[model samples]
Target chain A: MISIRWFLTLTLIALLVLVSFLSSLRGYRESMAEAETLFDLQLLEHVKLLGLLNPASFLFGNTLVIADSVITTPAELELSLQLLVVYQIFDREEKLVIRSENSPTENMAAFEPGYQHAEFNGYSWRALVAQDPLDGHWIMAAQRNDVRYRLAEAVTLQAVLPGVIGVPIAGLLIWWIVGLGLRPIQTLAASVRAREAGDLNVVELDDIPKELTPLTQSTNDLLTRLAMAFDREKRFAADAAHELRTPISVLKVQLHNLLHDLQSRQLPDAAVQTTRQSLQELGQGIDSLAHLIEQILVLNRTTPDQYMRQFTRINLLALVQDVVSNEFEQILARDQIFSLDGLPAFVSGDDTALRSLIQNLLVNASKYTPLGGQITITILQEHNKVLLKLEDSGPGIPEQQYAQVFDRFYRLPDAHHDASVTGSGLGLAIVKHIASMHQADIQLSRSQNLGGLCVTVIFQAYQQDNPA
Target chain B: MIDAVVIVLREVLEAMLVCCVLLASSYALGAKRIWLLPVTLFAVGGALLYATNLTALTDLFDGRGQELTNVLLLMLTGASLLFYLAQLPGVITQKTSGVTPALYASLIVASAAAMVRELAEIFIYIFSYGIASGQTAPVVSGAVIGAGVGVSLGIFIFFGLLWLGKRRCLQVSAVLLSLIGAGMMSQATRFLVQSGFLPGEHIVWDSSWLISESSLTGELLHALLGYDATPGIEQLAVYFASLLIAILLLRKLSVNQSLDVDSLRH
Candidate 1:
């Protein structure tokens, strides 16, 4: 896939360079054209001057100038094409008359009416031939071949110098400007990433480009729909539970009356025993149903999609520490030695959700562990992640059933066969789902130290600038 | 060095902009993505033509082959753009236009031709001046910097145009596109005169006395809108004709678009 930003930036820069080169090229060509025209004009001016000089002393001057040409060696000044200009004059009979200091002793060119490139002495020359229309005197102005090229190059370089210097600076400015223009998108993405799953508040961005306004609005709309769906789901579960419990309550009352009536009218011992056992099983089944209903509601409420709780910055250690304190009686009732250990780790999460998650894990540990067992909760900041490890002393779960245990209706084989322990089988499922919604990682393993189930949850830890 | 970079950057930006304009227009019409297919095909096509005709093209019309080819491409792009504008929602044959094969096909042809033309120039140029070296390093670095700047600016412009409310955005695009088409046509005519394929009435108006074409502003305007310092009679005629036709087509499209919208509402 092509990254639009990268593609656009690179392509534009290339195009800019090519265009600039073309501009320089044009400059170079134009400069050469101007040089040619200017040199031709100079030749024309020299022809007029040559017409002014009389041909009477032409032999003596030509001899003197040709003698001086060897001494002058004008070609040595390659930098200044100006110093290389050489001119010669001829009478109508093609006899050499006068010449410039550097002019060749030999005739420059055939008496052409216009420009001609020819060789004289040991070098090439660009010579323009102009004849006097009336007096028929001919004047030829010539400059060395290298001189014209050098002049053109110098002019071209002068014309292209600024381009060579300015493009980089312009490019840098453009890069910075592009970044500024594209910042809104980056900012929006960062803002969305920084929040927890529970954060369903409308995103707020100010002074973003007008184009991104609709995108933000749409994102907010999606959040709204999700929140409404969660509300409806939560409402349905609570309403159904409320309506169900009442009928179950009345049914329990009717069962009680039937038992009393049967007891008052004495029957055969075996028959009475069978009726009582049946009544007991029916009551147990209704209790389990009530428990299941409660667990299902909690599971639904804590799922990320249904999560509607508000987050508060809190010391995770302190919060979990309080939970242990509240559940101390239940732990002690099982004759378990419960311990809490860790520093005051900081994190942000929904208060009620975290409390329920902690309580459910604690309850499960206490219920499952044998009498005189040990339960330990550890919390601390590990790197940037806040880790919480809860270990219990009991027969550790089989390694393979670890994942299956988090399923809503899943119970361990041992728990299922042992009728002495009762469970709605939804505790860990709720814990896993809620932890996920909070963006925490959860791992279930056999505790190395306690020789029992270990539940570990890792939260992304962050500190408040000012502790309140 | 700076000159090489700026020249390349300008050409690449032209191609990039052509792609952006077509894609943006396509998205606005709620169409399937077909522009890339044509663009890629034509890029390869253009490359093949350049590669095969390297000698022949250089030798054509007495060594004016590249110029003639560029001129032809520019005219093709202009025609494609005109066709697109003519089919805007309510214009004649509006029923089969907009998101249909006609519209997307034209967009593809227009954008692809522009890209192929520009890319071929870039390929030729980069090769003409080899990699960065003792004499070329500065130019190469300048090219890199220019690339960054050009792409950044292109993105800014692309997003900025997209941000403009839909109707107005398309309108602004239409206007600029007309200017661009006309500019290309004018440049082609100028080349034609240069190649002696057309009569030269040099200096229809001499703006060079006021501002030389070699100056930065002059070069920039020339790149963006083909502003010539001393435009010839042929260039003026072609530029005006292209511009007028585009304007007329755009007006017709705009009027028809409103009618289409009203009919839909009813």
Candidate 2:
């Protein structure tokens, strides 16, 4: 589950930092260019001012413009050449005429009317020298090269540092903004989560984000589909009931009338026995119909999706014992030997669903087994799994029919032809559904000892904290 | 900030891209939700490895623990990817049930190993930079941006692959995925060379003049295709061997699927 909020916030912060950094880099280059241009103009202006000084001041061969600017000794802050301007006047013979107090008696540059670089002592200077045509004297004005570079760096840094410092503040803002943008989705999810279990109603959010509309629509689509399926299932049961109810009721009424008429006619003993036999057939038919309907209903209710919500820790041994007891009468009537085996085994599953599964297996065992047959039901824990096994001494299904037997209302040809045997053919289908719901593995095989059928269901063992 | 983001995004995107591809396939196979289990487990495992390394892990392999761990994870991921790639045979031929268990298990291992390796480095980098420096604003924002962009790009690639797959033969997607797997394994082989566990030549060819490996396009290609600026002979050999095996297996699976379809028609 990737959260949209996390993704968007991370993206927002990254974009901000990247944009800021690139912009600052561009600003640094532009600012340095601007600073260079400003320094050149100042250099040019200083050269002009020195050339315009009085010729006598130049002829005196004395220092000029040095008292106000020169620093024989200065404080740390005043050491920068940003405050110092030095100049010298040179004749055609390259002799020094007049200069600043501390200006070195050296040519800053050749008496050219353009900018140049020169060295004085161990330091480099940026200088512009201009010659006055009237007097044929050269005036050169210069400043330290390091001073200009330092100022350029300062200009760029001043422009960039704020954004660098702003990164964390921008991150916090992005976090809050992204959260605000995602609030609608969060609220929608919370509303959905807080709803009562099993309620698949369409969520009603007054305002929805464009991004989340599709999600909401899809969820609503699922709810609509579920609602439709539920309606169809309900209608199917009702329709089937309505269609079969009249015939069943009519049969019951006629059977009652026939029995009453036989008593009124004072029928002979042999005839009465035959009538009783026919009545027995009718009663069995009714029982099969009722059983079929009940199995159909149970199978529908336990459909994988429907029964997924109901899961609990259930004792397999107890459930098997109950089913065995309920089917004991039928087993005894057929003179079948029934045995129960193993200790209590607990598993995580739906109790009703597992109960139904147990009852069906027991009922099938009783129904299929011959007289004097043996049937065994067992429950045991193997490691972290609980296994439920049922075996009966009867004609087991052939290998080819195992898959077909799981289909709805499917009966073996032999079972269908047998006049004494009765079944609805839905027992195994219901059992399969329940097994699937609990994620239990079910298998059928020939009972090696019983020489008949064996059915086993393996369930995950659910440990319960019960000291009592 | 841009420099920081690019550095972090490079490593993050490689692992993230692999994850996106794996997750897409998992969803296609209808086993998407359960993948969270392995992802979380691997992340926690990586964190524990980071926390316990000096005190415990370095003792096991004589202080070469990191290299050893990387080798193990790479080998595991490679093997699992091979297993997963081969499972399409069962899916294509319908010889087994939907979403084979073997595929699920192998895919989980591959994704988990890859993710753990990548994420551990990221965690170490960010936390080791420290939070109390007051200088971490740029670092933090850059990391956040890198993470966001990497994941966002991964999503686009994932969807693009899926969309292209839907419009074309599945073999195309399979080939792309296999290529990525091969690329990773080759990089792992390079690590072995660097660690002195394998013999290698000096320099195969210097391609840096054409396109430096650290450039944006180079990084993207390196993540997707393992484009080394200078790959040695051993690395190339590993890459080709991995690709050959992957392609052959995918071809075999595709052939089996075709046969199944023909049989069904008959």
Interface RMSD, one decimal, each candidate? 6.9, 6.1
Best by lDDT: 2
lDDT of 1 by residue, B1-266 (tens): 44666677777677666666656555555557656786798887886678556788879878998788888988888788777876665432244434667877788888888877877766565555635333344445445545555555566566566667456556777777777778878988888888889988667788888877666677557656778988998899899998899988887868766656433221
Looking at model 2 chain A, report the run of 10 residues with the lowest lDDT sum. Answer: A61-70
Per-residue lDDT of A1-468 in model 1, one digit per residue for the tens?
234565455555556755775566576668778887886777677667666777774564543333344445555533443545688888788877777767777788888888898997788888888888888878888877766665665656666767767767776776777777778999999999998766788899888678998999999999989879877977898789777888888888988998898898869989999999999888888877877777776776665544434556868888888898898988878889988899998777777778878988998888888889999999978887898899998787788888898898788876523457788888888888778767789998989999898999998775465221
Residue B216 of model 2, lDDT score: 86
Q: Which candidate comes out best when scored by TM-score?
A: 1
Model 1 has fnat of 0.00
Which candidate tops DockQ?
Answer: 2
lDDT of 2: 0.76
Q: Go through the candidates in order and give the clash count of each.
A: 32, 2
- Model 1 chain B weakest 10-residue run by lDDT: B89-98
lDDT of 2 by residue, A354-406 (tens): 88999998888888888899999878889988888899889988978888888
Over 4 Å off, model 1: A57-59, A62-81, A133-135, A297-395, A414-422, A430-468, B1-266
